[model samples]
Target: MSTPQMIRTPLTELTGVAHPIIQTGMGWVSGASLVSATAEAGALGFLASATMTIDELERAIVAVKERTDKPFGVNMRADAGDAEARARLLTKYGVPVAGFALAPKQALVEQLKSDGIVVIPSIGAVRHAEKLQAWGVDAVLIQGGEGGGHTGAVPTSMLIPSVVSAVDIPVIAAGGFYDGRGLAAALAYGAVGIGMGTRFLLTSDSRVPEEIKRRYLAADLNGTVVTTKADGMPHRLLRTDFVEGLERTTGIGRLVDSAKRGLEYRRVSGMSWIEYLRDGIAMKKATGRSLAQMAQAANTPMLLKAGLVDGDTSAGMLASGQVVGLIDDLPSCEELVDRVVREAAERIRAAGATLVG
Candidate 1:
């Protein structure tokens, strides 16, 4: 079949991508390969940099540039110790976009915008979106409860329209979105596009291990559970033996485990104890997370690495969206983007036809 004509929206116009689909930056899953492929396929992709050191992130950025000249983004924690330095590195490379998991400071947003980089932050609440927009962010991506990892209680259907109505900036809807039908619905709801995490992570171009991919594929719609057991915040993850054990553990036991993981992370990340403490303090000030929650935050990357990179499901946790059950195949990024765009155009046209004069 001939390729479907490209559908342009505010997101596509701002990001310079042919399609409005966004492949979210999933730590340990989103890397150079996936981001480049997504960019080449005419969608925006973000390199997950929160898990990487500043040097690693620069290298990853260079790797993506080598693979594709298309515009892409790098996702980072706004409160990271090296955030300023990372921002400078992005400027050095002339990266097109910068994405933040948490709301960045006004200064950081200004710096990126001045450097000609589009700043898009992910938010879970309408207030957050309004604040980001007021702070002059280029756009915002809002993830609902059905999305993977840390999520809010509101479903996407309700959350998208709420934030869209509140913010003048472009809004990209996430959570429970995986295909063309979702794209159409998001646009109808006033969003400029849809951002997908789990759907992209399950793609053939993603670097997630084969075993881990199989595990994700086997899950049914009911296979995901949202629990605060992994971290102090509500995190959505696959229902695995490891996750179940975490849910069953007492608060004290979990705290002890969190301490252990925090130490392990410090070692793996090569951060001095002083540096670790500083980062913890920054996280506390930014998110208002308690000390215990700060320690538990260390568990997220380590556990995800074990499952997504090492393929050890028993030893690690898998962050996934409720949409996992809806996925069955591992199509390449190009094919997936093409199919979704085509289907969205057709659905939108069909829906418009039903409107009475």
Candidate 2:
């Protein structure tokens, strides 16, 4: 099929991509191969850097640059101790965008803007979106309750228009989005674009284990669950046996497991105990999470890596959107993006034809 005619939006104009679709930065999933392929396919892609060391992140950034000349972004942890250094890397390498999962400090926004880097933070609430807009962010990616990973309780249907109306900047709707029809719906709701995590994670270019990908494909609409048992924060995950067990376990049992995972995470991440404490403290202040919650949250990275990278479905948790139920095939990024754009355009045209003058 011919390439779909481009659909222009504030996001397309701002990011210089042919499509307004964005592939979210999912830890252990959105690596250079996936990001580069998505960029080449004319969608904005973000490399997940929160799981990478500074040097590893730089290497991944360089690798993406080597693979694709198109603009792409890096997703970062704003409160990370090395946040400034990561920002500097983006500036130094002339990366086009910087995406944050949490609201970054005002100074970081200013610093990126001064260096001509676009700042797009992922927010889950109207207040957060408004604050980021006031901080002069280029745009905001809003994930609703149905989104994977750490998520809020608000569904996209309500959250998208709410944030869009509350802020002047473009809003990219995430959570429960997977197809051209969904993209059309988001536009109808006043969003400039759509951001997809589970959709992108299932793509052919994603580095997730094939076994894990197959597991995602087999999921149905009810395959996912949002539970705080994972890290004391509401996280949407595939209802795997491991996650089910987690839900069944008492608080004490879960805490012990979290502690073990936290240590494993520290060892694998090369963080000293002091550095880990600093990060935990930072998390405590940022999210107002108690010490126990912070400890559980610290283990999340490792838990995800175990599933996505190591293919340990028994013990590792699979972060996923409810859209997992809707996904079946693993098309390459190019094919997937083109198909979505084409389908959306056709749907929009059909919808317009039915309108009365």
Candidate 3:
């Protein structure tokens, strides 16, 4: 298919991409290949650095740079032990954008902005968006409870407009978005763009193993459930037998499992026990989470790796949005982005034609 005309928005203008779409930095899924493919498709892609070591993150950034010269971004935990070092690395590499889940401190935002990097943080509520705007972030991506991973209780339709009205900065709508119709709806909600995680995670460009991808493809709209059983926070996951079994497990059983996963993560991550404690301390201070919650936090990445990297669904489950039910194919980034833009343009034109006398 031929390339469609660009759909310009504040997001495209701010990030210098041709489309007003963003591929979210999903842990264990969004990597160099996916980021590069999305960038080359004229949409902004964020490398998931929160799942990588500082050195691994640098190499991933280099891998993306080697694959494409298009502008892209990196997403990292703002409260990580190496947060400052990672911020400096973005400046060092001249990355065009830096995406964060937890809002970075104002000083870090200023530091990144000083180097001409656009700072966009993912927020789950109006208050967070307002706070990020006050902190001088370039934009905020809002994901509601229908989204994957840790999410809030509100749905996107209610959350996006609330955030759009509350914050002066551009809003990128996420959660339950998969196709051109969703993009058109998001624009009508006064958002400048849409950010997709599960949608992109199912793409051919995504590095998630095929077996896991097929499992995601097989899910229905009601196939996902949000449970604190995975971690001590609300994480939306596919309701496989393993996950349902997790829900049925006792609290003590859950804690024991969490401890085991934490040890496994420590081995794969090559983080010493002391270093892990330091990182947990930083998280505690940043999130004000309880000690138990923090221990559960360590279970997240390793569990995700079990499915996404190892393709062992019995051991873990897939993180996905409600939109996963609407998706069935694994199109390449180029095919996906192009079709979205074309379909959106057609829909927008059709809407206008209806109003024309």
Q: How do all models score by TM-score?
A: 0.97, 0.97, 0.97
Give the per-residue lDDT of model 1 (tens digit) for 177-269. Answer: 899999999999999999999999988999898888999999999999999988789999999999999899998988888888778888877
| Regions of model 3 farther than 4 Å from truth | 1-4, 352-357
Task: State how far residue 13 of model 3 sits from its true place (Å).
Answer: 0.5
The candidate with the higher lDDT, 2 or 3, is 2
Candidate 1 vs candidate 3, lDDT winner = 1
In candidate 2, what are the lDDT values of residues 223-302, reduced to their tens digit? Answer: 99999988999999998999999889898888898999999888877778888888777767778888778878977998
Worst 10 residues of 1 by lDDT: 1-10
How do the residues 233-335 of candidate 3 rate in per-residue lDDT, one tens digit apiece? Answer: 8999988999999999998888889999988887777788897888889888988888888888889899899889989989986898988888999999999
lDDT for model 2, please.
0.91
Question: What is the C-alpha local distance difference test score of candidate 1?
Answer: 0.91
lDDT (0-100) at residue 302 of candidate 3? Answer: 92
TM-score, cand. 3 vs. native: 0.97
The order of the candidates by TM-score, greatest first, is 1, 2, 3
Q: State, as a TM-score between 0 and 1, how close model 1 is to the true structure.
A: 0.97
